[model samples]
Target: MARRKTREEIKTQDKWNIEKMYPDNASAEKDLKESVSDAEKYGKYKGHLADSAESLADALIESDRIEQKLERAFVYSRMKLDEDNRAAEQQALYSKAAAAISQVSSLTSFVMPELIRIPEETLKQFIEDEPRLQTYRHLLDSAMRQKDHVLSEKEENILAQLGEVLSAPDQVFTMLNDADMKFGKIKDEEGKETELTHGNYISFMRSQNRQVRKDAYTHCYEAYKGMINTISANYSANVKTDVISARLRNYPSARAAALSSGRIPESVYDNLIDSVHSALPKMYEYVKLRKKLLGLDELKMYDIYVPLVKLPKKKIRFQQAVEIGKEGLAPLGDAYLQQFQKGIDSRWIDIYETEGKTSGAYSFGSYDSDPYVLMNFDSTLEDVFTLVHEMGHSMNSWLTRKTQPYVYGGHSIFTAEVASTVNETLLMKHLLKTESDPEMKKYILNMYLDAFKGTLFRQTMFAEFEKKTHEYAENGGGLTADWMNKTYDELNTEYFGPALSHDDYIQYEWARIPHFYNSFYVYQYATGYSAANAIADRILNGGEKERDDYLKFLSLGSSDYPVELLKVAGVDMSQREPVDRAMKVFSGLVDEFAELMEE
Candidate 1:
């Protein structure tokens, strides 16, 4: 077997291509100089946007041009640095670009507040006079919407200076988890011991041996327990940052600040929690049933991942995954199906797992390039699902970018997951319809059921935990390591009901989940899966109109708020219908799997 690439090798592999982002250090220095000069030029328009519609048009257009170019340059450089931070030279280049961007942001931050202060009539007149201003009407409206939240330019300066430090907790925690943390030893089924690390955790969880799974789970948490204090401190700092910023900006609460960025209503968060709380008994029932099927007297955290039926040991090759994914997605018609084929043919994916490569999967792109996917293939069924999942994200990006301008090219996280999950749903549906082997069909159905249980029920539990933790912190509860562990343990018991072993190390789970730092993010995984289930059902049911609307939703991007955009696709997350429908779908899957196991 080929050895995994060392971190050093991965860095060296990219050094030549990394220079393409900036040309060289000299080119980056030049761009910084030019960007600063453009900021000064754009800054001349503060408070004067109402002077004339045509002149306001000219100023706003120039501002966007400079902003877009400067942003692209910064993003490219930053992405390069992020790809491999072990190289000091790349890290230094990132710092240089960041400092310059910071300085430019300080010089230009007052323009929006100043523009909003202009009289509405005057702004209207400018837009009426300049036909080109139509392109920016929405942009101008968004800035004005924050009129009440604007602070003095001096206060803005102070906030701008504090940006890096305010963001330090999330940054530091990511580096600590991704680059530094090392859990010691785990024994496999063969009675041999190996070093355990973050990347290997998934492989171990997929191990068929029940004992191996338990050992990995408990040992991983044991290592995390040693560092829980530092992790808790980091979590507390991140939550406090949200609270402080929300108050400083005069938002109603930290939740408001977080949700408003995605243009989500606070009630959406509240409704998700409320509905999930109401449905907890159903979730608890599912858990107990899972434990019963596993034939365990009492389950533990490690038992959650093992399939209710052990899947046949079938290894799926990387190329086979591509073909199956293409065939599975063919129901969307040839044009859409061909994109998957093109993605594979064009090498838009970086396939194969290597050392130091990022774990998990994601699709990313620059405005100038086609979206690219990164994956770690291990020939397992889950790895195949991951391919379809990430392709869902890539295809969404491809469709949106091809259809929309740069300003509207990206959707919020609220809608982003809908695309990915829709693809996964369609893929699973395709396999279920065609497969002939009973055991294989059962295996596929079980995987699909697991997806719903994990994404919908499990993540809602996470969302509730997030909400209560934030509320606790907001109401003066200190987020000590014990508090974090205790709260998590309570939630584990509540969500899992009496299915789990009480003595298990479920309390340490919070220390391992990276999403806690993101505050209110995990819930979207649940909500997104719900919405995707509804929309994908519509598309698969021969609803031409519904399919068209969903395609339009993909292209809508940030042109509207997420709720309104979703409404166009005929799913309103504001109501609990989507969640209820999704849960029923999940129950049906559980029933199917239960019947299969009985056979």
Candidate 2:
């Protein structure tokens, strides 16, 4: 096996050009100071938005300018820190940038309440009187939509000041999981001492060697089990924060508060859970198939990730992965293809993993910068799919930035997942249509099935758990470690069904999931995957109208509500149709995979 490259060993061209945001620390510091000054000066608009149309317009414009600059500075610092978290200087830079942003947010906290205070008729007149405000119609409208939720200016300011303190749980969780936690070592198939890490836990789970998978699972969860009490306390505090904030905002539930920010209806969340529960039999069938294929007397949770039919390894280089991704995404049209090519040529991706670099992959940037991707590309088929996935996000960001102004350039996380998952779906379709090797074909089919199982089914299960836990907390129930464990364990059994044996350690899985801190965020993965499946099917089988509609959805950014934007893409997520359609697709894939294996 090839050794992983160190950051210093990786060629310059293979890394993302973060310097494009700032050539040096001195330059970043200069901009940081300028942004702080901008934020300080922005205080002049306090209690003055309702004075005149010109004042309102001026405040909005200046706020946008300050936010854009702060975003650029913050992104630069964040990328630097992610490149190597161990570096104290980079960490300090990130901290300073965060503090600067918090200060800006504190100063501007009164803007919303004051804007909400304007009479609806007067606000409409203000927009009409100041043509400049026309650009922010959606922005103003969204704030006004939350008029009932807006607290007094002083109360809002107090909440804003608590931002860092409120974030303690998430911060503590990150510090423990990423920086301090250790999972010890396990032996690989060849009996080599392999280290277990959060980054490679999934890889271990997917190992064909059942012992390795079992060892990895056991060791990983054992580490979490040791810290379960502490982690549970942190998580409970986080949940209480959510509950308190929601109540303070006059929302009936924490889930409602979280969804309202994206303008997604709580019914959409309910529909996802209900739809997935109705489709659990399909997942049960999937589990049964895996057990039969693996010839296991009884299946365990750790056995779920192993590929049913292992094929000869095919190693793709980074450049080859890029070319394949371009070909896979060609159905989207030439403009998108050209932009993707430009991003690649411009070093928009950090292409390899190195010590201290952040694990996993993400596409990130500001409105003014290129949609940059950070990837630990390893040249496996999984890596190729990841390449296309992040590109999906980048393309969406690229289009949104091009078509919308600064305020609307970033889309909601709900829509963001749809973009990335759509790419994964398209890539699977392209690979399946073109690949000739039967074993490789089976692998791809299994990959699609696994994606559905993980994204659609598993995430919905997580969504359900989050809902139940929040409800428990809202009712004044204590969120103890034993309670969380038992609750999570029961949910795991319910979702996985009778085909698999539930292990006690599996209850600790919730402690390992970092997304739980974000409060009701994982449901979007399930919903977005369902929406993407429906959209991908339309694009593949329908006419130009379908393709154009999806492209328009990408360009919309945050100009429209997420549900409405998805409707424009031909997936009405307000109903259960998309989730039902995705489940049908999963069922068909399972039937196809069984037939292929017989052949």
Cα deviation at 551, candidate 1, in Å, is 1.6
Question: Could you give candidate 2's per-residue lDDT for residues 1-599 as a string of tens digits?
Answer: 32345799999999999988888866777778888898888889998999999999999999999889889988998888878867788878887887777777788899999999999999999999999999999888999889989999899888887887888898688768866787888887778886776556787788899999999999999999999999999999999999999999999999999998778889889989988888888788889888989999989989999889887666799889889988888888888889888999999999887777777889999999999999887667888889889999999999999999999999898999999999899999999999998888899899999998889888898899899889999999999999999999999998888899778789999998888999899999999998998999899999789999999999999998899899999988888888888888888998898888878
List the candidates' TM-scores in order.
0.92, 0.97
Candidate 2 weakest lDDT stretch, 10 residues: 1-10
Clashing pairs in 2: none
Tens-place lDDT per residue, model 1, 1-599, is 22456545543332224343456656766776788788877767776766777767877778766766666566556555455545566567667667767777777777766677788777777777688888777667777777877788778877776766776787677667756676778786677787666656777876778888878887788878878899989988988887778789998778887787666887777776677677667666667777887788877778777776666577898789888888777766677888777877766676654544455667776555656676667788788789888988888888888887766777788998988988888888889999998888987887887787678767877887777777787787888888878888898787767767786477888877777777888889888998988887888886668778888888777777788889988899888889878777876776777778778
Query: For this target, which candidate reaches the highest lDDT against the unseen true structure?
Result: 2
On TM-score, the leading prediction is 2
Error of 2 at 10 (Å): 1.8
Query: Alpha carbon lDDT of residue 512, candidate 1?
Result: 73
Which residue runs of candidate 2 sit more than 4 Å off their true CA positions? 1-5
Residue 314 displacement (Å), model 2 = 2.5
